[model samples]
Target: MPKSLSNSYSNNTQPPFMLLIPQEEWQSLHEKLDRLTDMVEKTQRDSSNCDWLESEEARRLLGISPKTWQNYRDQRLIPFSQIGRKIYVNQADIDNFLLRHRIGEHR
Candidate 1:
């Protein structure tokens, strides 16, 4: 039988094992968690502010086909960044592109 079971059967008097941490170590862990949480929040805020559009999203926003999107890239008509094999555009750049190519009078 296991020591725990033997103890329980024999005496039933042993207290449960407890894990202990020093106050300073616990405080340090809490501080680290807080810092990590702050960093995550800041990252989310920054990403929200500087939104990025993927290739499909840009194509959909422009109402263009994939081939047309590729043509835009080949002709350097749009601003984009290629990371690895994926392309990304800034949301602000897409907005400006639309503004610059507006066809009719604003109402």
Candidate 2:
């Protein structure tokens, strides 16, 4: 056996683990990660700001039947928008509708 192998066996010691990364490279990696995180957060905020639900989705969200949904629209009880022949409701509008209809004592 090699002397080095014999010595390692006798001492029951393994080679030291080392990770070599330059300080500049490490800082650059962190900066890139921060930028990526910021971009992801901004995208999420932008998407949440403009969430548009279709008729079926709006009905499901409000727990109403198709007929009831149509009634609400005819009565102008819910906020909605129409593009061509398709209808869309903003999530914020749905949230506002829910808040307005909430059954509780005023604080």
Candidate 3:
């Protein structure tokens, strides 16, 4: 192969300004990237759905402040999940928590 036609980029001081990919490979890569993006978006939507309530949301639903909510958690009155720095409680658990504290019930 000629020197000018060589594919090596290590000899250049500056990085390659442009990349050339075959049309077929470019299209395939684009499709794969789109699919991965869709999968990530779907996962985020599913995790952040109404079934999992954030701290402020659950507190608002229960009509309590941050301290009271923390106390409830400490006492195990409700169940929660900690993902990274965010806390979440299941909607059904919130419902059960309220029901357990009911003063009187007909049935």
Q: Candidate 2 has what TM-score? A: 0.54
Model 2's alpha-carbon lDDT is: 0.89
Over 4-52, each residue of candidate 1 has an lDDT whose tens digit, in order, gives 6666653646655777999999999999999999999999999897699
Which regions of candidate 2 fall more than 4 Å away from where they truly are? Answer: 1-45, 48-50, 105-107
lDDT of 2 by residue, 1-107 (tens): 56876676545666567798999999999999999999999999998876999999999999999999999999888889999989999888889899999999789
Q: Give me the runs in candidate 3 sitting further than 4 Å from their true place.
A: 1-48, 105-107
- lDDT (Cα) of model 3: 0.88
Q: Which candidate has the highest TM-score of all? A: 2
Q: How many clashes show up per model? A: 0, 0, 0
Clash pairs, candidate 1, are none
Residue-wise C-alpha lDDT for candidate 3, range 1-107, written one tens digit per residue: 45665655455554446888899999999999999999999988986676888999999999999999999989988999999979999998998988888899589
Candidate 1: segments with Cα more than 4 A from true spot:
1-50
Steric clash pairs (candidate 3) = none
lDDT, residue 30, candidate 3: 97
Clashing pairs in 2: none
